[model samples]
Target chain A: MRKQHWIEVGVGAFMLFGIVALIFLALRVSGLTLDRNEPSFTLTASFSNIGGLKPRSKVTLAGVVVGRVTDIQLDTKWYEAKVTMSLEQKLEGLLSTDTSASILTAGLLGENYIGLTVGAETDVLEDGDEIRDTQSALVLEDLINKFLINSTKD
Target chain B: MIGLDSLARLGRAGLALMAALGRSGVLFFQAVWGWPSGQGVKLWMRQVHFIGVLSLIIIVVSGLFIGMVLGLQGYSILVGFGAEQALGQMVALSLVRELAPVVAALLFAGRAGSAVTAEIGLMKATEQLSSMEMIGVDPMRRIIAPRLYAGFVAMPLLTAIFAAVGILGGMLVGVDWLGVDEGSYWGTMQATVDFRADVINGMIKSVIFGLVVTWIAVFQGYDLVPTSEGISRATTKTVVYSSLAVLGLDFILTALMFGRI
Candidate 1:
């Protein structure tokens, strides 16, 4: 009877250990953050096309990640991808009203993200400020088409 | 006359193979149907102890060693390109996506699967199975079902433990042995790995592998020929077939899950 009870307890321990391991694996492999610790402020930007830009894509200034793009919506009137990003609160003084935002690719084949080039201006953009100066993603097909047209004419 | 005899022998082999497959299918369902009986609970517990609890140490030790090797190799390779910060991503992705499920299942088959086959084959050779049948006891329900069920239940959990332990092992080598920044190791991993793409699919792979390997192992045991040599041969076949099936299914399952097949 004691041996049977020990087996039962061992089985129970195995099951409990298994559950803990599974949860740990799930959290680790998913890249889900344990704490939402970054204090951030939201801003909007308009782009003609976002290409492969996603909601969780990084937002960078001078190649340093300062925020994450949170929401992307289609602007029906402008016919463009309107992106909402949340930046770290520390960048408020550094970015001006005239900052230029471009959808940039990381390396040759990396994921798409938002890159900011600061412009010279005294007025800092406030909360909910829409970035007006922007550049869209470069589509390879369109560039090829333009190149073909120019080459044929020449 | 010789040609006719060889053709007849080939036909008989084909018929026997089909008959074996059909009987295994019936045994699986019969066990499942008989699962609600009172003794079923006790039998399942015993099987789980045999299959799962006993196999824990080997699985954990192997997982750690594999992870350490991955860490050491990954660090060396990435050091060349100065992209060693991505070491966490490499280890986690490899473990969750492929290695953990496939390797652990292979090991399980060699250890638990061979044990299962030998036990069942011994019973058959000893005439215990025949005696049980004479007494009108359904041996499939009593013997085969619990073992099969326990395997299915225990496999995914074992696989998850393997992956987690492996990642932890990678951390030890990457952080302590190689002196990688601890924060970056975990941070890069968190930033890159996607839950649906890596973890869920990995767990699914492990479960399917468990089902396939266990099915082959139990079937090989239950259908063993009644002889000493036959019992030994069946045990060997269980290991061999389970390993082949796990690897082959992993390739097909991976393509289906990851590649748009």
Candidate 2:
């Protein structure tokens, strides 16, 4: 009975430690900020495809991340991918009415990110405004197939 | 005539083995599809509690050490090239893409996979599987399916734990030990690491590895001969085959995913 009790305790300790570790990890991944001072606004971008895109995916402009993708859904009427993004307060003035969103690759075979090409229009994009024009990512497989077909044709 | 007959018999045996493997593969898919309707969900919950919640400490401790070592080693290498700022990206990418899933799978195989083999092997030796069949209960659906589902579901969560701990470990080394700014470390990681496909690819691999490990364990255990030695052998085979399959499948997946990247 003593042996069994020790065994149970050992197992319990192992489980408790693991749970604590995982909780710590989840907190890290979520980037739970305590500051609460960082002002941010939301903007939406529509795409034909948003393959593998998820919430917390970084949003970049000119190779610098200014925000993150907060939510994604399929648009009902247009049958398109709708991605909602949150931008840092400092970047609010940078976005304009004519800003165009494009899906870009990080490396040769890296993950896809949404790149905002800030336009020169004087009208600044407000909170809740949708970026009208967007470009979807060129999937690797499609590009490879296209290359093969074109090369074969030549 | 005797030589020709022997050759024909050999060919028939080869064909039969192939047929068995094919059937096993089909059965695997059937088990997966039938999971929602079967008692698979209950088994899955038990497995998650056991494999995920239970094994959390080992995963975190191992993950933390792995991250620290990776940061130390990665920093040393990058320092040579004047690219120490790249450490965050290196650590995050490595943890998310490779170390987390593979390490989690290996550990799960040792902890839960061995238990699975032992449980099933004991049942087989005692003719419990046979008894279940006699009562019109399909052992594969009731027993094996749950284990497989549990493994498949638990792997990704375990991998997530690994990634989280690993990043924190790296952060500790980067910020506390190396004096790198926390903001810079996170900022670099966010900028350099491709989040979408890499995370998806890792999770997909975890699910596949989970399925393979569980299948191998159950298959070996259920087929164990009615002897102490046979049970031991089944346990050994389960670990060996599952590890090999995980490594082999990892290579294939890496090639398919990163080949174009």
lDDT scores of the candidates, listed in order: 0.89, 0.79
lDDT per residue (tens digit) for residues A1-154 in model 1 = 8988898998999999999998897676566656677677888999988989999899999999889999999999979889999999888766899999999987665679999999999998888999999999877789899999999998
Q: Write the per-residue lDDT of candidate 1 for residues B1-261, one digit (tens) a residue.
A: 999999999999999999998998987787667673587777888888999999999999999999999999999999998878889999999999999999999999988999998898888889898899999988888888888888888999899999999999999999999998888788888888788778889989988888877888888888888898898899899999899999999999899988872
Task: For residues A1-154, write the lDDT of model 2, one tens digit per residue.
Answer: 6754554455455445545544543334433445645789999989999866778788988888788898999999999999999998887766889999998876665567889898889989888999998999888899899999999998
Model 1, residue B174: C-alpha shift (Å):
1.5
Quote the TM-score that chain A achieves in each candidate. 0.81, 0.74
Give the Cα error of residue B109 in candidate 2, in Å: 1.7
lDDT per residue as tens, model 2, B1-261: 999999999999999779767766876776666574545555555555666666777887999999999988988897887667778878888987898889989988888888899998999889998999999987877777777777776677778778878988988897789876677677667655554466667778888888888888877787677788999998998888889989999999999988885
* Candidate 2 pairs with clashing backbones: A18-B56, A18-B57, A108-B261, A109-B261
Candidate 2 local Cα displacement, residue A90, angstroms = 11
